[model samples]
Target: MLPRRFNLHRPDRIEDAVALLAEHGDDASPYAGGTELLIAMKARVLSYAHIVDLKGIAALRGVSARSDGGLIIGALTTHHELANHSLVLERLPAYALLSANVANIRVRAAGTLGGNLCFAEPHADPPAMLCALNAELVLAGPGGERRMLLAEFILGELSTARATGEVLVRIEVPGLPAGTRAGYRAFGHLERPAVGVAAVALPLGKGFDWRLRVGSICGRPTALAGLEKAMRGLPEADALAVLAEGAEQAAAAVEADDDIRGSAEYKRHLVGVLARRAARAALGMEALAA
Candidate 1:
Protein backbone atom coordinates (compact mmCIF):
# COMPACT_ATOMS: atom_id res chain seq x y z
CA MET A 1 0.00 0.00 0.00
CA LEU A 2 1.06 3.60 -0.59
CA PRO A 3 1.79 6.06 2.20
CA ARG A 4 -1.40 7.37 3.78
CA ARG A 5 -0.20 10.86 4.55
CA PHE A 6 0.50 12.09 1.01
CA ASN A 7 -2.13 14.22 -0.72
CA LEU A 8 -3.30 13.54 -4.29
CA HIS A 9 -4.64 16.21 -6.64
CA ARG A 10 -6.31 15.40 -9.96
CA PRO A 11 -6.47 18.27 -12.34
CA ASP A 12 -8.94 18.22 -15.24
CA ARG A 13 -7.18 20.65 -17.49
CA ILE A 14 -3.62 21.36 -18.59
CA GLU A 15 -3.66 24.86 -17.19
CA ASP A 16 -4.74 23.60 -13.79
CA ALA A 17 -2.06 20.96 -13.83
CA VAL A 18 0.56 23.53 -14.65
CA ALA A 19 -0.81 25.81 -11.95
CA LEU A 20 -0.64 23.08 -9.35
CA LEU A 21 2.92 22.24 -10.35
CA ALA A 22 3.88 25.90 -10.15
CA GLU A 23 2.23 26.26 -6.75
CA HIS A 24 3.59 23.07 -5.22
CA GLY A 25 6.81 23.35 -7.21
CA ASP A 26 9.38 20.89 -5.88
CA ASP A 27 7.13 19.43 -3.20
CA ALA A 28 4.71 17.97 -5.72
CA SER A 29 5.51 15.22 -8.22
CA PRO A 30 3.49 14.82 -11.38
CA TYR A 31 2.04 11.33 -11.52
CA ALA A 32 1.50 9.77 -14.95
CA GLY A 33 0.93 6.00 -14.88
CA GLY A 34 2.56 5.72 -11.42
CA THR A 35 4.59 2.66 -12.42
CA GLU A 36 8.04 4.10 -11.71
CA LEU A 37 7.10 6.81 -9.23
CA LEU A 38 5.25 4.45 -6.92
CA ILE A 39 8.03 1.88 -7.06
CA ALA A 40 10.62 4.51 -6.28
CA MET A 41 8.51 5.86 -3.45
CA LYS A 42 8.15 2.39 -2.00
CA ALA A 43 11.92 1.91 -2.12
CA ARG A 44 12.46 5.31 -0.46
CA VAL A 45 14.38 6.62 -3.43
CA LEU A 46 11.87 9.44 -4.04
CA SER A 47 9.67 11.32 -1.63
CA TYR A 48 6.96 13.91 -2.29
CA ALA A 49 4.37 15.44 0.04
CA HIS A 50 1.80 15.90 -2.73
CA ILE A 51 1.19 13.94 -5.94
CA VAL A 52 -0.20 15.71 -9.01
CA ASP A 53 -2.00 13.10 -11.03
CA LEU A 54 -2.15 13.79 -14.80
CA LYS A 55 -4.65 11.08 -15.68
CA GLY A 56 -7.74 13.25 -15.42
CA ILE A 57 -6.24 15.79 -17.80
CA ALA A 58 -7.62 14.67 -21.20
CA ALA A 59 -5.24 16.89 -23.11
CA LEU A 60 -2.28 14.68 -22.20
CA ARG A 61 -3.56 11.53 -23.83
CA GLY A 62 -3.97 10.07 -27.34
CA VAL A 63 -2.09 9.67 -30.65
CA SER A 64 -2.77 11.50 -33.87
CA ALA A 65 -1.12 12.27 -37.17
CA ARG A 66 -0.03 15.80 -37.71
CA SER A 67 -0.67 17.92 -40.82
CA ASP A 68 2.96 17.64 -41.84
CA GLY A 69 2.87 13.84 -42.07
CA GLY A 70 4.42 13.51 -38.59
CA LEU A 71 2.97 12.00 -35.44
CA ILE A 72 2.12 13.67 -32.12
CA ILE A 73 1.84 11.48 -29.03
CA GLY A 74 0.41 12.92 -25.84
CA ALA A 75 2.17 12.38 -22.51
CA LEU A 76 -0.41 10.10 -20.92
CA THR A 77 -0.56 7.66 -23.83
CA THR A 78 0.19 4.22 -22.40
CA HIS A 79 2.78 1.85 -23.83
CA HIS A 80 0.09 -0.70 -24.64
CA GLU A 81 -1.87 1.87 -26.59
CA LEU A 82 1.21 2.91 -28.52
CA ALA A 83 2.14 -0.66 -29.34
CA ASN A 84 -1.34 -1.34 -30.69
CA HIS A 85 -1.96 1.95 -32.50
CA SER A 86 -2.41 1.38 -36.25
CA LEU A 87 -1.02 4.79 -37.14
CA VAL A 88 2.10 4.17 -35.04
CA LEU A 89 2.58 0.73 -36.61
CA GLU A 90 2.29 2.20 -40.12
CA ARG A 91 4.38 5.31 -39.53
CA LEU A 92 6.96 4.22 -36.94
CA PRO A 93 7.12 0.46 -37.03
CA ALA A 94 10.46 0.18 -35.24
CA TYR A 95 9.20 2.23 -32.30
CA ALA A 96 6.06 0.12 -32.12
CA LEU A 97 8.21 -3.03 -31.99
CA LEU A 98 10.35 -1.59 -29.23
CA SER A 99 7.31 -0.42 -27.29
CA ALA A 100 5.81 -3.88 -27.51
CA ASN A 101 8.90 -5.39 -25.88
CA VAL A 102 9.20 -3.12 -22.84
CA ALA A 103 8.99 -5.35 -19.74
CA ASN A 104 5.80 -7.43 -20.13
CA ILE A 105 2.06 -7.09 -20.55
CA ARG A 106 1.49 -5.75 -17.02
CA VAL A 107 4.20 -3.11 -17.14
CA ARG A 108 3.23 -2.08 -20.67
CA ALA A 109 -0.38 -1.76 -19.58
CA ALA A 110 0.57 0.65 -16.77
CA GLY A 111 3.53 2.57 -18.19
CA THR A 112 3.15 5.91 -20.00
CA LEU A 113 5.47 7.14 -22.74
CA GLY A 114 6.11 10.48 -21.08
CA GLY A 115 6.70 8.80 -17.73
CA ASN A 116 9.29 6.50 -19.31
CA LEU A 117 11.05 9.43 -20.97
CA CYS A 118 10.90 11.49 -17.79
CA PHE A 119 12.47 8.73 -15.73
CA ALA A 120 15.44 8.73 -18.18
CA GLU A 121 16.76 5.45 -16.83
CA PRO A 122 19.85 4.30 -18.74
CA HIS A 123 18.38 0.85 -19.25
CA ALA A 124 15.07 2.19 -20.54
CA ASP A 125 14.34 1.60 -24.28
CA PRO A 126 12.20 4.48 -25.56
CA PRO A 127 14.68 7.37 -25.37
CA ALA A 128 17.20 5.64 -27.63
CA MET A 129 14.51 4.79 -30.16
CA LEU A 130 13.18 8.33 -30.01
CA CYS A 131 16.66 9.70 -30.52
CA ALA A 132 17.11 7.42 -33.49
CA LEU A 133 13.99 8.87 -35.10
CA ASN A 134 15.03 12.43 -34.24
CA ALA A 135 12.01 12.97 -32.00
CA GLU A 136 11.18 16.33 -30.45
CA LEU A 137 9.85 16.99 -26.96
CA VAL A 138 7.22 19.65 -26.30
CA LEU A 139 7.30 21.10 -22.80
CA ALA A 140 4.80 23.45 -21.22
CA GLY A 141 5.63 25.59 -18.22
CA PRO A 142 4.74 28.95 -16.68
CA GLY A 143 6.90 30.59 -19.32
CA GLY A 144 4.88 28.80 -22.02
CA GLU A 145 5.60 25.82 -24.24
CA ARG A 146 9.01 25.21 -25.77
CA ARG A 147 10.49 22.44 -27.84
CA MET A 148 13.75 20.52 -27.57
CA LEU A 149 15.30 17.69 -29.47
CA LEU A 150 15.18 14.25 -27.92
CA ALA A 151 18.93 14.18 -27.29
CA GLU A 152 18.81 17.52 -25.49
CA PHE A 153 15.80 16.49 -23.41
CA ILE A 154 17.61 13.46 -22.02
CA LEU A 155 20.80 14.88 -20.54
CA GLY A 156 22.26 12.05 -18.42
CA GLU A 157 21.46 9.13 -16.21
CA LEU A 158 18.20 9.69 -14.34
CA SER A 159 18.30 13.33 -15.45
CA THR A 160 16.28 15.33 -18.00
CA ALA A 161 16.03 18.89 -19.25
CA ARG A 162 12.69 19.29 -17.47
CA ALA A 163 12.83 22.08 -14.92
CA THR A 164 10.63 22.94 -11.97
CA GLY A 165 6.98 23.67 -12.92
CA GLU A 166 7.41 22.22 -16.39
CA VAL A 167 5.41 19.40 -17.90
CA LEU A 168 6.46 17.29 -20.89
CA VAL A 169 3.28 17.42 -22.93
CA ARG A 170 4.00 15.55 -26.14
CA ILE A 171 6.53 14.04 -28.52
CA GLU A 172 6.63 14.86 -32.24
CA VAL A 173 8.33 12.56 -34.71
CA PRO A 174 8.62 13.50 -38.36
CA GLY A 175 7.79 11.04 -41.06
CA LEU A 176 10.57 9.07 -42.67
CA PRO A 177 11.18 9.06 -46.41
CA ALA A 178 10.23 6.20 -48.72
CA GLY A 179 13.60 4.44 -48.48
CA THR A 180 13.83 4.52 -44.71
CA ARG A 181 14.04 1.38 -42.59
CA ALA A 182 14.70 1.22 -38.87
CA GLY A 183 15.33 -1.64 -36.44
CA TYR A 184 15.92 -2.25 -32.69
CA ARG A 185 18.00 -5.05 -31.17
CA ALA A 186 19.58 -5.90 -27.82
CA PHE A 187 21.32 -8.51 -25.71
CA GLY A 188 20.26 -8.95 -22.11
CA HIS A 189 22.06 -10.60 -19.20
CA LEU A 190 22.37 -14.37 -18.92
CA GLU A 191 19.27 -14.48 -16.78
CA ARG A 192 17.45 -11.57 -18.44
CA PRO A 193 18.42 -11.31 -22.07
CA ALA A 194 15.14 -9.60 -22.82
CA VAL A 195 16.17 -6.38 -21.06
CA GLY A 196 19.78 -6.17 -22.22
CA VAL A 197 21.65 -3.60 -24.29
CA ALA A 198 19.10 -2.13 -26.75
CA ALA A 199 20.18 -0.45 -29.98
CA VAL A 200 18.12 1.30 -32.68
CA ALA A 201 19.08 2.21 -36.25
CA LEU A 202 17.34 4.29 -38.92
CA PRO A 203 18.36 4.20 -42.53
CA LEU A 204 17.45 7.27 -44.49
CA GLY A 205 18.87 7.31 -48.03
CA LYS A 206 21.50 5.04 -49.55
CA GLY A 207 24.82 6.76 -48.95
CA PHE A 208 25.39 9.35 -46.23
CA ASP A 209 21.88 9.83 -44.90
CA TRP A 210 21.65 6.78 -42.63
CA ARG A 211 21.23 7.48 -38.92
CA LEU A 212 21.72 5.33 -35.83
CA ARG A 213 21.05 5.58 -32.08
CA VAL A 214 21.92 3.20 -29.25
CA GLY A 215 20.51 3.18 -25.75
CA SER A 216 20.31 1.17 -22.47
CA ILE A 217 24.11 0.78 -22.39
CA CYS A 218 25.40 4.25 -21.67
CA GLY A 219 24.51 6.90 -19.10
CA ARG A 220 22.15 8.47 -21.68
CA PRO A 221 20.77 7.23 -24.95
CA THR A 222 22.92 8.73 -27.72
CA ALA A 223 22.79 9.37 -31.42
CA LEU A 224 25.59 7.58 -33.23
CA ALA A 225 26.50 10.58 -35.39
CA GLY A 226 30.21 9.88 -35.46
CA LEU A 227 29.48 6.35 -36.57
CA GLU A 228 27.04 7.58 -39.18
CA LYS A 229 29.64 10.03 -40.46
CA ALA A 230 32.24 7.30 -40.66
CA MET A 231 29.87 5.13 -42.70
CA ARG A 232 29.16 7.94 -45.12
CA GLY A 233 30.52 7.53 -48.69
CA LEU A 234 31.60 3.98 -47.93
CA PRO A 235 30.44 0.63 -49.27
CA GLU A 236 28.66 -1.93 -47.10
CA ALA A 237 31.81 -3.63 -45.76
CA ASP A 238 33.58 -0.33 -45.20
CA ALA A 239 30.48 1.12 -43.59
CA LEU A 240 30.34 -1.85 -41.20
CA ALA A 241 34.00 -1.29 -40.25
CA VAL A 242 33.36 2.41 -39.76
CA LEU A 243 30.33 1.62 -37.65
CA ALA A 244 32.43 -0.61 -35.37
CA GLU A 245 35.02 2.14 -35.01
CA GLY A 246 32.31 4.67 -34.24
CA ALA A 247 30.86 2.37 -31.61
CA GLU A 248 34.26 2.25 -29.93
CA GLN A 249 34.49 6.01 -30.02
CA ALA A 250 30.98 6.40 -28.60
CA ALA A 251 31.74 3.90 -25.82
CA ALA A 252 34.81 5.91 -24.91
CA ALA A 253 32.85 9.18 -24.96
CA VAL A 254 30.24 8.03 -22.41
CA GLU A 255 30.68 6.40 -18.98
CA ALA A 256 28.51 3.31 -18.79
CA ASP A 257 27.49 2.67 -15.19
CA ASP A 258 27.91 -0.74 -13.65
CA ASP A 259 25.02 -2.27 -11.75
CA ILE A 260 23.36 -5.61 -10.96
CA ARG A 261 22.99 -6.18 -14.73
CA GLY A 262 26.69 -6.09 -15.61
CA SER A 263 30.04 -4.30 -15.24
CA ALA A 264 30.88 -1.11 -17.07
CA GLU A 265 33.25 -2.81 -19.46
CA TYR A 266 30.75 -5.58 -20.10
CA LYS A 267 28.05 -3.08 -20.94
CA ARG A 268 30.38 -1.19 -23.28
CA HIS A 269 31.22 -4.37 -25.11
CA LEU A 270 27.56 -5.29 -25.32
CA VAL A 271 26.81 -1.87 -26.82
CA GLY A 272 29.54 -2.34 -29.38
CA VAL A 273 28.20 -5.73 -30.44
CA LEU A 274 24.63 -4.52 -30.57
CA ALA A 275 25.65 -1.41 -32.46
CA ARG A 276 27.27 -3.54 -35.13
CA ARG A 277 24.23 -5.80 -35.38
CA ALA A 278 21.88 -2.84 -35.59
CA ALA A 279 24.06 -1.24 -38.23
CA ARG A 280 24.01 -4.44 -40.25
CA ALA A 281 20.26 -4.70 -39.98
CA ALA A 282 19.93 -1.09 -41.08
CA LEU A 283 22.17 -1.82 -44.07
CA GLY A 284 20.04 -4.81 -45.00
CA MET A 285 17.00 -2.59 -44.93
CA GLU A 286 18.81 -0.14 -47.15
CA ALA A 287 19.56 -2.95 -49.57
CA LEU A 288 15.93 -3.97 -49.64
CA ALA A 289 14.96 -0.37 -50.22
CA ALA A 290 17.47 -0.19 -53.05
Candidate 2:
Protein backbone atom coordinates (compact mmCIF):
# COMPACT_ATOMS: atom_id res chain seq x y z
CA MET A 1 0.00 0.00 0.00
CA LEU A 2 1.07 3.54 -0.63
CA PRO A 3 -0.04 6.95 0.60
CA ARG A 4 -2.07 8.97 -1.80
CA ARG A 5 -0.17 11.66 -3.64
CA PHE A 6 0.25 14.85 -1.57
CA ASN A 7 2.22 18.05 -1.61
CA LEU A 8 4.92 18.24 1.08
CA HIS A 9 5.37 21.63 2.73
CA ARG A 10 8.44 22.35 4.85
CA PRO A 11 7.59 25.25 7.12
CA ASP A 12 10.51 26.73 9.05
CA ARG A 13 8.20 28.81 11.21
CA ILE A 14 5.29 27.74 13.38
CA GLU A 15 3.29 30.67 12.02
CA ASP A 16 3.82 29.44 8.46
CA ALA A 17 2.82 25.91 9.38
CA VAL A 18 -0.37 27.14 10.99
CA ALA A 19 -1.12 29.26 7.94
CA LEU A 20 -0.65 26.27 5.62
CA LEU A 21 -2.92 24.15 7.75
CA ALA A 22 -5.51 26.90 7.92
CA GLU A 23 -5.46 27.30 4.18
CA HIS A 24 -5.61 23.59 3.36
CA GLY A 25 -8.17 22.85 6.09
CA ASP A 26 -8.97 19.14 6.45
CA ASP A 27 -6.84 18.32 3.42
CA ALA A 28 -3.63 19.27 5.24
CA SER A 29 -1.99 17.37 8.10
CA PRO A 30 1.00 18.16 10.30
CA TYR A 31 4.00 15.87 9.84
CA ALA A 32 6.52 15.15 12.54
CA GLY A 33 8.44 11.87 12.88
CA GLY A 34 5.59 10.25 10.86
CA THR A 35 5.73 7.18 13.04
CA GLU A 36 1.93 7.12 13.44
CA LEU A 37 0.53 9.35 10.69
CA LEU A 38 2.51 7.70 7.89
CA ILE A 39 1.24 4.28 8.86
CA ALA A 40 -2.37 5.44 8.65
CA MET A 41 -1.68 7.05 5.29
CA LYS A 42 0.03 3.92 3.96
CA ALA A 43 -2.90 1.78 5.05
CA ARG A 44 -5.27 4.18 3.23
CA VAL A 45 -7.18 4.80 6.44
CA LEU A 46 -6.19 8.47 6.28
CA SER A 47 -5.39 10.77 3.40
CA TYR A 48 -4.13 14.31 2.95
CA ALA A 49 -3.56 16.80 0.17
CA HIS A 50 -0.65 18.43 1.98
CA ILE A 51 1.81 17.19 4.57
CA VAL A 52 3.18 20.14 6.54
CA ASP A 53 6.55 19.30 8.02
CA LEU A 54 7.32 20.85 11.39
CA LYS A 55 10.76 19.32 11.81
CA GLY A 56 12.40 22.48 10.48
CA ILE A 57 10.78 24.68 13.12
CA ALA A 58 13.51 25.64 15.59
CA ALA A 59 11.20 26.23 18.54
CA LEU A 60 9.82 22.70 18.42
CA ARG A 61 12.98 20.90 19.48
CA GLY A 62 14.79 20.43 22.82
CA VAL A 63 14.20 19.61 26.50
CA SER A 64 14.83 21.92 29.40
CA ALA A 65 14.05 22.16 33.10
CA ARG A 66 11.65 24.84 34.32
CA SER A 67 12.51 27.29 37.07
CA ASP A 68 9.85 25.51 39.12
CA GLY A 69 11.76 22.19 38.87
CA GLY A 70 9.34 20.78 36.25
CA LEU A 71 10.45 19.89 32.72
CA ILE A 72 9.33 21.24 29.37
CA ILE A 73 9.65 18.76 26.51
CA GLY A 74 9.43 20.00 22.94
CA ALA A 75 6.89 18.42 20.66
CA LEU A 76 9.61 17.14 18.34
CA THR A 77 11.47 15.24 21.04
CA THR A 78 11.83 11.58 20.08
CA HIS A 79 11.11 8.65 22.36
CA HIS A 80 14.75 7.54 22.35
CA GLU A 81 15.86 11.03 23.29
CA LEU A 82 13.61 11.18 26.31
CA ALA A 83 14.49 7.64 27.37
CA ASN A 84 18.13 8.66 27.84
CA HIS A 85 17.87 12.40 28.59
CA SER A 86 19.68 13.20 31.85
CA LEU A 87 17.12 15.73 33.06
CA VAL A 88 14.22 13.35 32.51
CA LEU A 89 16.14 10.50 34.17
CA GLU A 90 17.04 12.57 37.23
CA ARG A 91 13.69 14.24 37.88
CA LEU A 92 11.14 11.90 36.34
CA PRO A 93 12.59 8.40 36.29
CA ALA A 94 9.21 6.74 35.86
CA TYR A 95 8.57 8.82 32.74
CA ALA A 96 12.02 7.90 31.44
CA LEU A 97 11.26 4.22 32.01
CA LEU A 98 7.97 4.54 30.16
CA SER A 99 9.69 6.24 27.24
CA ALA A 100 12.19 3.38 26.99
CA ASN A 101 9.34 0.87 26.64
CA VAL A 102 7.50 2.60 23.78
CA ALA A 103 7.24 0.20 20.82
CA ASN A 104 10.63 -0.98 19.43
CA ILE A 105 13.92 0.69 18.66
CA ARG A 106 13.08 1.99 15.19
CA VAL A 107 9.74 3.50 16.11
CA ARG A 108 11.19 5.00 19.25
CA ALA A 109 13.90 6.64 17.18
CA ALA A 110 11.45 8.25 14.79
CA GLY A 111 8.32 8.80 16.87
CA THR A 112 7.57 12.13 18.49
CA LEU A 113 5.67 12.55 21.75
CA GLY A 114 3.43 15.22 20.22
CA GLY A 115 2.47 12.88 17.38
CA ASN A 116 1.75 10.12 19.85
CA LEU A 117 -0.61 12.34 21.84
CA CYS A 118 -2.31 13.85 18.81
CA PHE A 119 -2.79 10.44 17.23
CA ALA A 120 -4.78 9.46 20.32
CA GLU A 121 -4.23 5.74 19.90
CA PRO A 122 -5.80 4.01 22.88
CA HIS A 123 -3.16 1.32 23.19
CA ALA A 124 -0.32 3.84 23.13
CA ASP A 125 1.73 4.19 26.36
CA PRO A 126 2.51 7.88 26.87
CA PRO A 127 -1.01 9.14 27.52
CA ALA A 128 -1.53 6.79 30.46
CA MET A 129 1.64 7.81 32.23
CA LEU A 130 1.12 11.45 31.41
CA CYS A 131 -2.35 11.42 32.88
CA ALA A 132 -1.10 9.73 36.05
CA LEU A 133 1.86 12.10 36.33
CA ASN A 134 -0.40 15.15 35.86
CA ALA A 135 1.23 16.53 32.74
CA GLU A 136 0.04 19.59 30.84
CA LEU A 137 0.04 20.05 27.07
CA VAL A 138 0.86 23.26 25.25
CA LEU A 139 -0.88 23.99 21.96
CA ALA A 140 -0.36 26.70 19.36
CA GLY A 141 -2.60 28.05 16.63
CA PRO A 142 -3.45 31.22 14.71
CA GLY A 143 -5.09 32.64 17.81
CA GLY A 144 -1.99 31.90 19.88
CA GLU A 145 -1.09 29.31 22.51
CA ARG A 146 -3.03 27.76 25.37
CA ARG A 147 -2.28 25.16 28.02
CA MET A 148 -4.48 22.26 29.01
CA LEU A 149 -4.24 19.13 31.07
CA LEU A 150 -3.48 15.87 29.25
CA ALA A 151 -6.84 14.52 30.39
CA GLU A 152 -8.62 17.34 28.58
CA PHE A 153 -6.38 16.96 25.52
CA ILE A 154 -7.28 13.32 24.97
CA LEU A 155 -10.97 13.12 24.13
CA GLY A 156 -11.50 9.56 22.98
CA GLU A 157 -10.22 6.67 20.85
CA LEU A 158 -8.13 7.91 17.94
CA SER A 159 -9.20 11.46 18.78
CA THR A 160 -7.93 14.58 20.60
CA ALA A 161 -9.02 18.03 21.59
CA ARG A 162 -6.61 19.74 19.17
CA ALA A 163 -8.46 22.15 16.96
CA THR A 164 -7.83 22.50 13.25
CA GLY A 165 -4.72 24.58 12.43
CA GLU A 166 -3.31 23.89 15.89
CA VAL A 167 -0.10 22.05 16.77
CA LEU A 168 1.10 20.51 19.97
CA VAL A 169 4.05 22.71 20.89
CA ARG A 170 5.30 21.03 24.05
CA ILE A 171 4.45 18.94 27.09
CA GLU A 172 5.11 19.89 30.69
CA VAL A 173 5.28 17.35 33.49
CA PRO A 174 5.17 19.05 36.86
CA GLY A 175 7.64 18.01 39.46
CA LEU A 176 6.07 15.59 41.86
CA PRO A 177 5.78 16.92 45.38
CA ALA A 178 8.05 15.30 47.95
CA GLY A 179 7.19 11.75 49.04
CA THR A 180 5.37 10.99 45.80
CA ARG A 181 6.51 8.21 43.44
CA ALA A 182 5.18 7.10 40.08
CA GLY A 183 5.23 3.70 38.37
CA TYR A 184 3.72 2.12 35.25
CA ARG A 185 2.80 -1.49 34.44
CA ALA A 186 1.07 -2.98 31.43
CA PHE A 187 0.06 -6.28 29.76
CA GLY A 188 -0.60 -7.27 26.19
CA HIS A 189 -0.01 -10.18 23.85
CA LEU A 190 1.24 -7.99 21.01
CA GLU A 191 3.42 -4.95 20.41
CA ARG A 192 1.05 -2.43 22.01
CA PRO A 193 -0.48 -2.66 25.43
CA ALA A 194 -3.94 -4.17 25.84
CA VAL A 195 -4.19 -3.00 29.43
CA GLY A 196 -1.86 -0.53 31.10
CA VAL A 197 -1.92 1.04 34.52
CA ALA A 198 -0.04 4.02 35.96
CA ALA A 199 0.13 4.99 39.61
CA VAL A 200 1.42 8.09 41.37
CA ALA A 201 1.61 7.54 45.08
CA LEU A 202 1.92 10.15 47.83
CA PRO A 203 2.54 8.30 51.06
CA LEU A 204 1.44 10.35 53.99
CA GLY A 205 0.81 9.48 57.63
CA LYS A 206 -0.22 5.81 57.66
CA GLY A 207 -2.02 5.00 54.34
CA PHE A 208 -1.28 6.60 50.96
CA ASP A 209 -3.05 8.94 48.55
CA TRP A 210 -2.81 7.83 44.93
CA ARG A 211 -3.49 9.00 41.43
CA LEU A 212 -4.21 5.82 39.49
CA ARG A 213 -5.02 5.52 35.80
CA VAL A 214 -6.14 2.61 33.61
CA GLY A 215 -5.39 2.81 29.90
CA SER A 216 -5.62 0.68 26.69
CA ILE A 217 -8.70 -1.15 27.92
CA CYS A 218 -10.69 2.06 27.69
CA GLY A 219 -11.39 4.71 25.08
CA ARG A 220 -9.09 6.99 27.08
CA PRO A 221 -6.94 6.85 30.16
CA THR A 222 -9.41 6.88 33.04
CA ALA A 223 -8.93 7.20 36.76
CA LEU A 224 -9.95 4.24 38.91
CA ALA A 225 -11.84 6.48 41.28
CA GLY A 226 -13.60 3.86 43.37
CA LEU A 227 -10.56 1.65 43.84
CA GLU A 228 -8.30 4.64 44.42
CA LYS A 229 -10.52 6.05 47.14
CA ALA A 230 -10.73 2.66 48.77
CA MET A 231 -6.97 2.24 48.91
CA ARG A 232 -6.40 5.67 50.44
CA GLY A 233 -4.14 5.70 53.49
CA LEU A 234 -4.13 1.91 53.62
CA PRO A 235 -0.95 -0.17 53.81
CA GLU A 236 -0.01 -2.62 51.09
CA ALA A 237 -1.65 -5.62 52.69
CA ASP A 238 -4.71 -3.66 53.73
CA ALA A 239 -5.00 -1.82 50.41
CA LEU A 240 -4.79 -5.02 48.40
CA ALA A 241 -7.03 -7.14 50.55
CA VAL A 242 -9.64 -4.39 50.94
CA LEU A 243 -9.52 -3.04 47.41
CA ALA A 244 -8.82 -6.18 45.36
CA GLU A 245 -12.51 -6.70 44.81
CA GLY A 246 -12.99 -2.98 44.36
CA ALA A 247 -10.50 -3.04 41.51
CA GLU A 248 -12.62 -5.55 39.61
CA GLN A 249 -15.65 -3.36 40.13
CA ALA A 250 -13.72 -0.30 39.07
CA ALA A 251 -12.54 -2.08 35.93
CA ALA A 252 -16.15 -2.71 35.08
CA ALA A 253 -16.64 1.04 34.99
CA VAL A 254 -14.20 1.76 32.15
CA GLU A 255 -15.37 2.20 28.57
CA ALA A 256 -14.10 -0.91 26.74
CA ASP A 257 -14.79 -2.34 23.34
CA ASP A 258 -14.58 -5.82 21.84
CA ASP A 259 -12.38 -5.63 18.77
CA ILE A 260 -9.39 -7.61 17.52
CA ARG A 261 -7.59 -6.96 20.79
CA GLY A 262 -9.81 -9.00 23.11
CA SER A 263 -13.25 -9.26 24.62
CA ALA A 264 -14.46 -6.36 26.70
CA GLU A 265 -14.74 -8.57 29.74
CA TYR A 266 -11.20 -9.88 29.32
CA LYS A 267 -9.72 -6.41 29.01
CA ARG A 268 -11.79 -5.20 31.93
CA HIS A 269 -10.35 -7.96 34.10
CA LEU A 270 -6.80 -7.19 33.04
CA VAL A 271 -7.23 -3.56 34.14
CA GLY A 272 -7.83 -4.71 37.71
CA VAL A 273 -4.78 -6.94 37.71
CA LEU A 274 -2.54 -4.31 36.16
CA ALA A 275 -3.84 -1.56 38.41
CA ARG A 276 -3.07 -3.53 41.54
CA ARG A 277 0.38 -4.47 40.30
CA ALA A 278 1.12 -0.92 39.19
CA ALA A 279 0.04 0.52 42.52
CA ARG A 280 2.20 -1.97 44.37
CA ALA A 281 5.13 -1.15 42.12
CA ALA A 282 4.68 2.56 42.87
CA LEU A 283 4.65 1.83 46.58
CA GLY A 284 7.87 -0.23 46.37
CA MET A 285 6.10 -3.39 47.50
CA GLU A 286 6.24 -6.76 45.80
CA ALA A 287 4.93 -5.96 42.28
CA LEU A 288 2.50 -8.80 42.38
CA ALA A 289 1.35 -10.55 45.50
CA ALA A 290 1.66 -14.31 45.89
lDDT of 2 by residue, 174-266 (tens): 876677777888888888999889888877667678788988887789998887788888876787786577888888988888978889999
Q: Candidate 2: where is the Cα deviation over 4 Å?
A: 286-290
Given candidate 1, what's the lDDT at residue 167? 86
Q: Give the per-residue lDDT of model 1 (tens digit) for 151-176.
A: 89888878999998888899999876
The segments of candidate 1 whose C-alpha lies over 4 angstroms from its true place after superposition are 190-208, 235-238, 244-254, 284-290
lDDT of each: 0.75, 0.87
Q: Tell me model 1's lDDT, rounded to 2 decimals.
A: 0.75
Indicate which candidate wins on lDDT.
Answer: 2
Cα deviation at 32, candidate 1, in Å, is: 0.8
